[model samples]
Target: MNTNNVLRQITYEIYKQRTVMPEKMRTNYRIERANGGLLCDLWFLTVGCIHDAQGGCVMCNYGKGSGVVHWDKILGELKKIVERLPWEFEDFLLTPSGSMLDEREVSKSMREDLCGILKGIRTKRFIIESRADTISEEGLDFVKKAVPDAEKYIEIGVESSNNWILKHCINKNTTYEMFQDAVQKIHQAGMYVTANIGLGYPFMSEKAAIINTVRSIKDVLNDGADSVVLFPYHIKKGTLLNVLSENGMYRCVSFWSLAEVLGYFSETELSKIQISWYKDYFGEEKSYICSSPGTCPNCERKVLKELDEYRETQNPEIIRRLREYPCSCHAEWKQQMDRENGQIDIKRTEEEYRKLAEIYKTDRQLLEQEIGIMKDEFMRRYGNE
Candidate 1:
């Protein structure tokens, strides 16, 4: 078998052996109004991800729960969340650890209870997050049957259409072909496909990250995705990204980058997707990397306010206004992007060296020198670093 295949088997073994903490198997819920008249009641299931055994995505911390708990108990907890939800919500978003439809992460019994909750709530529409490999037509069909009266939409994490980034950078263990197939099947079932595109992968420059994200969005939309959600790269504790950040290999994208990327999309295109990121999703104690409150103390308020306004209105003029908002660090951000472009694959190379340095304590200086040489050579080849 190939290396990834072998790794997958090993990880599955690890998952099987790992213990689950019942208390951690919790849920997080929130309510928000979407553009037009859609009221969204969103929630996250803490029952850990199946892929966690294989090392979860670099930026994801949602799979923190152990899925080893009792299905009935998990269902009982979800019922409490259902009770907390407002009496009426037009759209219900259930994004659990990994794919909500994945029976491994969310047991069949748990899924049944989820379906019953949807029916009981009588929502006009509902959305679920899923990975490409686990999204089967039959599973979605089951959801449709359960929510016969409501419109069903599936949100897949098509982080990047580029296979290299998906595998090497994000460790998603999914392919573009798989995503395309999933989207095709979702559309075949007469359901809307919403893809969440990841931005700011470590190995590439900001410009490259934006280009890849925009391309993925267009490709998926062209393929069958009705909408796309932009997830700016963020770091979390205990993830590979956190390690990289400590080594000065990764930096979180500023809000300016978010604005620049969204500005690239047309007003009509912007309206189709979800982009209200300023409202903290993780609550008080949970920490997020690169998502600082605002660009600066003085500029943050206006930037966040404008972002919310643009998300609701999708007015090109609002984006234009944001693009013009002057910040002291704008020039520095541009220069950083340019230098990062020139540096090219530094993050990947640095990651390998980091692992080696951690193993051979005495050789840390040698590793640093080697990285310096690599950077110098890169600069020589591409004008500047």
Candidate 2:
């Protein structure tokens, strides 16, 4: 069986065990800097990611807080939250637990109701997120009609530009071509694109991860991304990454690696980039995050503090200072980066999959059959791409 197939099977098996609890709504509110000013960012829990139910990305554990979704209650709560916000916020970002455009996760009625609430807000810019495949002309038209005066941005996750890496390493099941198509549609709708890029995919050295991420950033920008958001890999509980970390096969992206990626971009390019999921700038849910990007204990706090400040200010000088900051771990990290190949270790990956199957008591034959069917469909869609 192909390595991607095996990994996907393992992911599906693990994800199948998740228990859906009764309805409960959870929301997180934060004040962040965006479009050169303060922004009100609101995150609401939904049912879950539809992709996740079908064995999603290797590193993602989104919608962990999701329960049985109550759309009316969620909208009501959202209205109350928006009503309570001070008039000082010039920008507003509404992020659901999953793709806002995927009706299975967030229904059209809920979105229409949510848009009604947004239409009443006084924000200058309105932002929302969706998967590349979920973006549609109808949805964009509805949003544009609702917030006619606000600058609109649709954030999409394009983790990497390399299809092979996306398939075998991250298992994102999203192609760069799909992202390009989404970008074209968003641009046609007169909306800005915020491409979300992930750093530190498993089975690569820090140096290789940095290179891949930098390449992805450049690719997205060239493909018409108005801005980019860098999400340094977070090891979330119950995620494949967490399993790999426990088995000593993976580590979160190092702070040094993040600095290296930033170093590759000029100050002007850096202005269009935003770093996310670093050391707890957004009041990250502790129950979800097993670990985030960091260095040693000696410099971790100082480094993260500076990174938080940089995230808010987007100052190139802060990145320069980070590069110059001295630490013993920096030399060690560099050595590992230089010594290791970036390729995935197929042997170890397969062994881990087998072990997971054993531990989870998964039916190997049935899983293999499912993977075979998936492989057939994948090849049919993207043959020799």
Candidate 3:
């Protein structure tokens, strides 16, 4: 079906509508509990994700604010941020808007320069994020050398274990085998690996989303991941998810669904799971996020509080409490999950594809053909059920 070509065509059409702008980016940091101690989480801006230029993830808008790369300006700002930090931290996380290991995003010389600026920080564990394909032995070795004093951890966004969902749904362009290979490389380098699992993709039923996420979590854990991070769906501007939501074909994932997914694991597994982007953290700018996971106005605040507590404590009892917590929307969410029609609706999906074809001026016949193929494949896979 040439899914990449289709996704790229739509992505380029959306990109044409976007205006490039330069704004004063800020570095955000926060202290949180992890591994029985305080962990410092820090995020900085860079040239942005390289994949965004070629039809990136459906739910991501990380590359929107970025334009061209100015290494001097970015490194100078990072140095200023590092200078302001305290002498020591228990665990330090340095996250960039894009994959730090991608040379196109952050060149080798620039990485060395940034590492020079960060080498002085005393930390027990140093964590960074990268895409699975970019996680080479050289990159892992460089990070180990750059931060010799601390234990190294690389986080890769393995959004789903299902290759079909990874390609047709999220447009991630990564496979489960690629993720396993990356994890093995990291482990061979004597480092830790964390997998980031995403929930709430378009055209996926609530029950299917939860089930897929749970399976993904288990897959990564069994593949030697040291921890997992759960990222609930956030509708961001300038992405395919936003387009779907605007057209009434999508809705934000409910917080209860996240709680339900967490409940499937024991306290030991739960301890290794951390929820992020459910709500804003580090006082970062959220103007780009149209909506995030939530239940209702009545219980939103309390649910968020419990989620935050769970993030900090990793206590299974909190999830149990949330399961028992009363809310008017809970029943509705349960009903959606318990419904028999738990697969993607091929008819609605084809309609949306047709609408996209008209709006983006693509080939209507080709989209129809692709959708027909997808429908047949779905039936062949699930008809017996």
Residue-pair clashes per candidate, as listed?
A: 1, 0, 0
Model 1 lDDT vs. the true structure?
0.66
Number of the candidate with higher lDDT, 1 or 2: 2
- Give all candidates' CA lDDT scores: 0.66, 0.78, 0.79
Mark the 10 consecutive residues where model 1 has the least summed lDDT.
1-10
lDDT score, candidate 1, position 270: 75
Q: Find the 10 residues in a row with the least total lDDT in model 2.
A: 279-288
Clashing pairs in 2: none
Residue-wise C-alpha lDDT for candidate 3, range 237-263, written one tens digit per residue:
788888989988788889999999998
The residue ranges of model 2 lying beyond 4 angstroms of the native Cα positions read 1-4, 21-24, 64-67, 281-286, 342-385
Question: 134-225 in candidate 2: lDDT tens per residue?
Answer: 99987887678666788899999889987766876787777888999999999998899999999998765666678789989999999999
TM-score leader: 3
For each candidate in turn, the TM-score is: 0.81, 0.88, 0.92
Predicted candidate 1 versus true structure: per-residue lDDT over 1-385, tens digit per residue: 0013322332344344434433653555666555545455445455567676565566665545553555566567778777666566667777776677787776676677677866666577778888888888668876787668788888888888866567545667788889888888888888888888877776566677776677777787778788887877666654556656776766776777787777777777777766745457556564443343247666877887887776666667877887777787766666776765533465665665556356334255555665675556555644542
lDDT of 2 at 350: 51
Winner of 1 and 3 under lDDT: 3
Descending-TM-score candidate ranking: 3, 2, 1
Give the number of the best model, judged by lDDT: 3
